[model samples]
Target: MASKLIHAIYKDDDLVLQAVKQIRDARYHIGEVYTPFPVHGIDKAMGLAPTRLAICSFLYGITGLTVAVLMMNFMMIQDWPQDIGGKPSFHFYQNMPTFVPIMFELTVFFAAHLMVITFYMRSKLWPFRKAENPDPRTTDDHFLIEVDASDHNVDKLTDFLYNTGAAEIKLIEN
Candidate 1:
């Protein structure tokens, strides 16, 4: 089914919170909210699920660390096996101090690159990505709420918005 958006352009944080409260009171479904900056208590007002990004980030970091360790160990011990400068050949783990720099570099390299890619993917942000915002001003100045109306009364929705201090309200098909 095609999604619908009940778009409201709010003037300030107060208006945003007021709308959020109205929506909660009426028990309306909200799809997403767009704001130039965070509105304090907005999430609580919307009753949004806490983001899982932190868990995903930690998992990605651990994966990067594992990759780094495996690659470094494979290259240094198995690939070349160089006895350069008379360093231990078979078990460099004896001194192990020498491999610290390589391990650190690989870990940092993998973590930095992988984290960037993972974050972008998780956010669905990529190059040439043009987002659909009903009012460009919302991206700069206004606060916006995009509510998902589920076969409900449009007049009632507008009435709720009016009561909640929404400066402007429009509907968009998403």
Candidate 2:
């Protein structure tokens, strides 16, 4: 049988938290949540694990450092060695100060560019991908709660939603 997704839309974050608290306290399964703006502590309340973005960020930073080192080394030592001042020679590691700017720029460059790419990939945002939104209004001013229930508990779910302060209730299929 195909699964059904029931979404209860709310306008306020506090109501969402309260409804989530009720469902969590009663041991109900929440499929997911959608919010326009991030509500602090919602993830914790939903028992979500911490993300590994930090690790990805570190790896991206290392990629930047590697690019910077290799590029500077190639230009100064291997490819085109140019003498800026007579006091120093055109050696890369020997003239470490000259590579500082490249290093800094690469670090920032890799972090920002790669971080965005990683985020988009992880979110499955690519060309021609079907959107996952149940309600278009959710992207602007609504918060959503998705619950899984069969015909047996649909009424109960809707009642709970109405009693819990949902602005609107709708059943969606995915």
Candidate 3:
């Protein structure tokens, strides 16, 4: 099936943000926005739901912590029980303070790496993936807002986009 969309180009991030708010306030359905850099609060302006990446990060961190604890316990307490610098390795609880650094580092490592992987998966971004932006200029200096033009009057939408300070407008059919 083919669809029609209006691409509104803005030169400044602030203008794009304002245009997004105006578009939403005017009851227009925005398909997406492509910008050169992250615009703070653009997701809120677009009425997008909050992300759950933080929850994923927390779970990954817990997994790392558990692995660190188990590995430390097995290697230090169970596998080769030893006395180093007068600190006994017979009990995990008694020697937990010495393992704190490992636990913390592993937890952070897992959270950061896994969160990045989760974000890439969630965004469907991977190596050799084709770029989806309609305008390549959006990757450099411009911001583009894609509006669904299916059920709306194209002329009116163009006028609205112009009023919202769009530097350029294009109607694309897909």
Candidate 4:
């Protein structure tokens, strides 16, 4: 059997948020929501867990720091010990001050770059991926809530959405 979805379109963010809360309260499943931009507190309203991207960023930063330390140690101390201005480079600890800048830069670089890649991969936004927005207006000035209507009364759901301030409602089968 084809699954039916109700697209409840709203003109304002507050209306969409309120509708989402009411629908969830009424025990109707919300498939997804599309907004012109980020909507604050939407994740909590959608009952989504907090993301772990920060932990990934920290690990990436630590990896970069370790790489920087090892590379500097190998190059300056083990590979070629130089004596410029009588400043000995015999030990990494002794030349640690000079490597501080590189360490900091590498840590930030790794954290930032890896976080971007992680975000893209997690969001399934790989290169050349097709857009998934149900309506072009959602990318401009509209908000959309996709409610699951497979086992529900479509007329009642449509009426409920209209009562919840949906500017437009579309019934789609998938």
Candidate 5:
């Protein structure tokens, strides 16, 4: 079955933001939004919840920190206990300051790399994947809001979008 969508095109981010708020206020379901750049406050206007990526990053950092401590403990304490600079390698606490830089580096490395991977996986932006933008102009200078028109009167929705400052309106079936 083909789903119908109304693509409302706006020339400016502000115009699209305003249209999104108005459309949501009118109780219309928005399928998606495509824009040349990130629009400020569009997520709030579209009534989206806050993302939990930060929490994931924090957890990843903690995991990295744990891994670093374990690796250092195994290598320096259990594997090869070397007494360098009169510091005992058997006790991890005695030489903890020397491993601080490595621990910090590993924590940041894991958090940043894993966060990026998580973001890509969550967004489904795999390599060689096709784009989902209905209008190519959205990749340039336009902002497009896809309003679900399957359950609504298309004529009324189109009129409402036009009045909400859409420069171009398109009815698409997908």
Candidate 6:
């Protein structure tokens, strides 16, 4: 079955935000929204759930810290003991101060890299991936609101979108 959708393009981000609020208030099902840059509070306006990426970042940082500690312990104390700067490598705790900088750096490195990779994978934006935006202008200067129109009146939706300050409206079927 073919599903009908209405693409509402707004020139300004503020207008798009207002249109989204109006559309949701009118009980219309919004399929998606595309924007060139981040629109603050858009997720809340769209009634989307909060993200859990911060939790993942924390876990990744902990893992990196653990790995750094173990690696330093094994290399400095267990594998081959070293005496540098008159500091004994007999105990990890005794020489822990010197490894603090390495541990902190590794923790930040792992969290940042893993968070970026996770964001890319979650958004399905891997290298060589085809673009899924319905309008090319959305990547430049337009913000698009995709409304589900399968069971709604097309003319009414068009009127509502037009009234809500849409610069352009396009009907798409899939």
- Per-model C-alpha lDDT, please? 0.78, 0.85, 0.95, 0.94, 0.93, 0.96
- The sequence of per-residue lDDT tens digits that candidate 2 reaches over residues 119-156 is 98998898798988878888999999998875438888
Q: What is the lDDT of residue 46 in candidate 4?
A: 85
Which window of 10 residues has the lowest lDDT sum in candidate 2?
A: 84-93
* lDDT, candidate 5, 1-174, per-residue tens: 679998889999888888998999999999899999999899999989999999999999999999999999999999999988898886899889999999999999999999999999999999999987788998999999999999989999999999999999989988
| lDDT for each residue of candidate 6 in 1-174, tens digit (9 for 90 to 100) | 899999999999999999999999999999999999999989999999999999999999999999999999999999999899899888999999999999999999999999999999998899998888889998999999999999999999999999999989999998
Candidate 3 residue spans exceeding 4 A from truth: none
Model 1, C-alpha of 106: deviation from truth (Å): 3.3
Error of 2 at 97 (Å): 1.6
On TM-score, the leading prediction is 6
Q: What TM-score against the true fold does each predicted structure earn?
A: 0.74, 0.87, 0.97, 0.96, 0.94, 0.97
Per-residue lDDT over 18-97 for candidate 4, one digit per residue giving the tens place of the 0 to 100 score: 99899998899999999999999888888889999999999999999999999989988999889977889978998898
lDDT of 1 by residue, 1-174 (tens): 776678878888787888888888888887778888888888888887788766666666677667766776777787877776987668647536876776667666766777788878978899999987667888888988887775888788888887788888898775
Tell me the lDDT of model 5 at 62.
Answer: 100
Model 2 error, position 53 (Å): 1.5
In terms of TM-score, which candidate is stronger, 4 or 6? 6
| Model 6: CA > 4 A from native | none
Q: What is the lDDT of candidate 2?
A: 0.85
Clashing pairs in 2: none
Clash number for every model? Answer: 0, 0, 0, 0, 0, 0
User: lDDT of model 3 at residue 35?
Assistant: 97
